[model samples]
Target: MSVDPEIFAKVKEALIDALGVDDDEVTEEATMVGDLGAESIDFLDIVFKLEKSFDITIPREELFPDDILTNADYIADGKLTADGLAQLKERMQFVDLTKFEADPQVQNFGNLLTVRDLCSYVATKKA
Candidate 1:
C-alpha cells in the first residue's frame, strides 16, 4: 500500500523529535533501530509522540508485539518458528516482513520496523 504523504510527514516529524535524528535520515526504508538509532527505551517516547501528533491511541502490542517475541510457542533456536512468523504477519500488517521472514531471528526483529511501516500504522489507526 502507498503511504499517505501527510501521515509520512507526521511520522517523520515524530521520529525526528523523539529519536533526535536528521530529517534526511528518516527515509521510508530506514529501519527504526538500525538506521535511526532507536533503542528499546526510545519507543515509549516515539509512541507518545505519534499518539499526540495523530490524535490516536497506540497500544503497545500493536507496535512492539513483545508477547510474540518472548513467547516460547513462537520462538525456537533463536529464530521465530513458522507459526511465530505467521503470527507476526497477522499482527503487523502495516510492516513489510519479507526481509525479517527470510531470517526470522528474534534478535533481528528489532530492526524490522521502518519509517514507512510507522506511517502505515498511523494510517491504519487514523482510519
Candidate 2:
C-alpha cells in the first residue's frame, strides 16, 4: 500500500496524544517496546486502535507475538509482515468510533510513532 503523509500525520498525532510522548522521540526507527515502554496490554490497544483508526485487521501472527507490537529488528529486515499492504487497499474511510473507545493505550497513545505504526496508520487511513 502507498504511504499517505496526511494519514501518517493523524496516526502520529494520535500516538503522541495517547502516549504523552514528544514527537521527536517517535521516529520511524524507534523501538516501540524497549524505547517506548509499551506493555503487552498497551500493544494490544495499539493494535486495536490501528485497526479502528485505519479500518484494517492486522494478521494475528504478524502483529502480535509474545503479546507486543515492536520494532526491535524491523529496520534491518524492512517489515515482519504485510499489514500495511492489507490496510492500503482502502484509504479514505476513517472509523471514528475506534478512537473514542478509550483503550488502555489511548490514555497514553501519543508516543508510538514507529515505522510499522506509521505504515499501518498511513495504509489504514488512506484505505
Candidate 3:
C-alpha cells in the first residue's frame, strides 16, 4: 500500500509530541517498542495517535495481540532510509537508534524492548 508524504510528517510529529523525541530520529525503521522504547501502554497510545493522524484503522491485533515480525525480519526489511517505502517497510520491522542522542526520552524506552514487544511491534506495522 502507498502512504502519503505528509503521513511521515504527521506521524513524526505525533511521535515527537507524544514521546518527546525528535522527528528526524523517527525513521520508518523505528519500531515503537524496540527503538523508541515504548511501553505496552505507550505503544497503545502511539497506536491511537498514529491511527488518528493517519486516519487509518490500525487493528487492535496490529497494536496489541499478534506475532508481528522476527529478528530475521529486521534483516529482511533492511534499515530505515530516506525513501518512504523502504522506511515504512523497515519501520514495520525494526527501530533504528543511530539518532537516539538527539532524543533523551528515547532512554526512557529501554524497558520496553522485550522480544515479544520487538516482534509484535513489527508485526503490527506490517498489518
lDDT of each residue in 19-69, candidate 2, tens digit only: 667888766556576566666666666667767777777654444332222
lDDT of 2: 0.49
Angstrom error of the Cα, residue 120, model 1: value is 0.5
Residue 70 C-alpha lDDT in model 2:
45
Tell me the lDDT of model 3 at 94: 40
- Give the alpha carbon lDDT tens digit for every residue of 13-127 in model 1: 9999999999999999999999999998899999999889989999999999999999999898999999999998999998889888898999999988988888899888988
Q: What tens-digit string does per-residue lDDT give for candidate 3 at 23-112?
A: 667776576665665666766776677777656667665334222222233222332223432433344444333343233232333432
TM-score of 3: 0.45
Residue 100, model 3, lDDT: 33
Q: What C-alpha lDDT do the candidate models reach, one value each?
A: 0.92, 0.49, 0.49
Ranking by TM-score: 1, 2, 3
lDDT of 2 at 83: 42
User: Model 3, stretches more than 4 Å misplaced?
Assistant: 1-3, 67-127
TM-score (all chains, Cα) for each model: 0.96, 0.47, 0.45
